[model samples]
Target: MKLAELAKELKIPTESFIKFIQDFDLELSECISTNFEVKDDFAKFARENIVFLRKYSEDLNQNKSIEDIAENIDQPKDKVAEIIKKDKPKLFDNGKYKSSVSSFGIDNKLGGNYKFVYNYFGKNTHLAERDFIGYRDLFFFVSQTLEPYLSNISVQDWGIHRPAGIVLYGPPGSGKIFWAKKIAEIIDYEFKEIKKYFLGISFVDDQKITFNDFLIQIMKSEKTLLFLEDFDEIMSERSEDESVKSDDEETKEIILHYISHFEKENILMVGAANSLEKIDRELLAPGRFDVLIPVFPPNMKERSEMLFHHMTEDLSPDALLIKILEDNKAHQLPFWLEISKKMQAFSNTMLIDFTQSLKKRIRNLYLKNNSTTIKITQKMLDASLRDASSKLTGTYLDQIQQFIYDVSLNNYEDFTVRIEALKVEVEHYKIVDEPTKPIGFTHNDEIKQKK
Candidate 1:
């Protein structure tokens, strides 16, 4: 087979094919174009090491580090370095290197290794597997988002032009941005923030140039989690019915351009929005973003986890804690519960705030004895809950419930049931606690005897 024909069949760049000729040390001229004929020797080389060649090219194209490339192929770094130096020295330039296969017939609109830029956003973030905790089902769903990267599967198998992106929508302080960072850490993908990128662009022409260049760089190099924080403020709905007016045309174009790019770009565009209603109706199409995950305020079970995680940090006995909880008549029958049912709708942030306030209150209450002892009392916790902003209004809760129903309509039936169950739980949350102790009164009898 001719090298050009091989390039067409494999759908790889002609430059990469030339690299095969140079690497295998086949009978090919230095000036050989795409039309160069393949010999029996090159055919045998392809047959024996085709898988290796493909992986090598992918690692190179991703601009992986020398250590990573070596580890991936199960070869030593020194050996791989020797192979590259002996075979293709053109790739290395003054300690800088380019992808082994790049600058195809796409007309040089974009090309570069930008893995550094992507990973820089999440430099200090090291989230362990346990750090991604929420619900068991939700954790599984988020894990599935990385299926394409974790396996040999292709997006075409799922009938998608490119892998779908995720949009996490919920109220403020619900840990939307935090999850995005953790997801990126799990996949070890490049994490790039979008808001600052827009602010850094100085001119209209620069918007077009920067967007095109950056996206192409992302598509070529490796996987990326593009965190579009404040997505609602950035990308407004596309109003096709009328001529939409905007004070900044450049910003508008930049947003629409990148959102549209998710259709074909392999990168994951994780957009966080407080409300899905603010997003454009058209942008929810299957190709743009396939998943609409609702990050509602922690329900009863999750709120309990958050509370216990913070509350049980002391060595105090469970007996003491239960006694303190029982005195307030707040958590009802199960002493393990955190906060009253009315406060279940409060976000994790608000719950943490409430717990911290309790600690402070407990300290002040213990000071009445003029001692530094850490003996927490019921009065302290009750006063703290009253002081903290644990009251999520009825109207806001109703809105969140409606949003859950709306988004669940787009998901599987099982997910719909899970979300709907929360509403049912909220309706009956005010169950009264039956006290174990009763009061005895002799005031009336004593008064009659005295008379």
Candidate 2:
């Protein structure tokens, strides 16, 4: 069933239903397909929970104060205010919360009985088989953008055509290339990277070829997804401060010429960019590279899971490391919670660095002690974290902030919670040094000046 059809049957607004799913942080792929087709499990869940859904929708549409919310949820006003403050909800003119201030979010935080929403799906058997660690929301968003390729109905009935080009924008090490490959996998396309040399007239297999010829050749063949790196630089709007290379101009022209035929030719081009700030406006027109997907770093929960996964991935049950992890409860999520919190804004690459450093440290410790009873200590964890923090520089944080701002302008509604959470995490790095006393200035002199 289409999501709209379900919403009609339930007498709920389709937009509200979508927001409800997002506010609850539900796994979107499980509830709805890329083309907004309602899954059987979600349909059942909605049917059974119609009463709850109606109340949530009603509350969601209202601009309520903390007192009103507290009264509605039967919680203490103080607690509700605290949660609201923590979440940093938008405010109305009269100091009431905006409709975007999710009551469902607050209720859930206050120990509301929403476990059924998650429990209905039961154990996620598919998650274990996933290629990447987290960002279920991002994966879902990418799937939706590719719905035209996945579903014929989306094209024929809804007029949703496959995007000719896509730009995956994010900070460095945020896994843009990983998602570009995932896009190809999702659409069952041949993954072909357009190397820099391919842009120029270059010899491939002793045959002279230009980028135009390469693109033509790919189009002539089966379905293909062409991945391009440094898209922001290559396709940047030509400005006096920055000169465009002749090759880059040619490449852009060729792409613009060929993009209109991409859908018909079974070709898709995905460009990886650090930011979209400098990309040419023409490139973002509808049916061109209009589909912009923002890849984000792992959140706190995902960070912990990733750490746990990396630590014990290939270890035997009886390995000394496993035993040590088990002894310290290091194999569990809680063991890594504090360290992962400190690793806020750290990219996937940085997390891997932390794991690698920690593993080498453990190896050295074992070599020195030759004991099976070694424990994973906080000192070792902190040392590994310091190594990872090398890459979490001030400039990287600024990039993350810029990415956050870009998403706020482009993809905020779809990823509100993540954007807000990341904003706070980035702010965590802000340092304020105490002002030092002026040289040769004594306390009595300061007191006299004050007098």
- Predicted structure with the largest TM-score when compared to the true one: 2
lDDT of each structure?
0.53, 0.83
TM-score of 1: 0.53
**Clashes found in each candidate (C-alpha, N, C closer than 3 A):** 0, 0
Instruction: Write the residue-wise lDDT of candidate 2 on 279-306 in tens digits.
Output: 9999999989999999999999999988
**How many backbone overlaps does candidate 2 show?**
0
Runs of candidate 2 exceeding 4 Å displacement: 1-72, 84-105, 114-119, 122-131, 152-160, 316-318, 412-417, 428-451
Clashes of 1: 0
Which digits, one per residue and each the tens of the lDDT, describe model 1 over residues 167-212? 8877677788877886676556778886545433334554443554
Per-candidate TM equals 0.53, 0.81
lDDT score, candidate 1: 0.53
Q: Give the TM-score of candidate 2.
A: 0.81
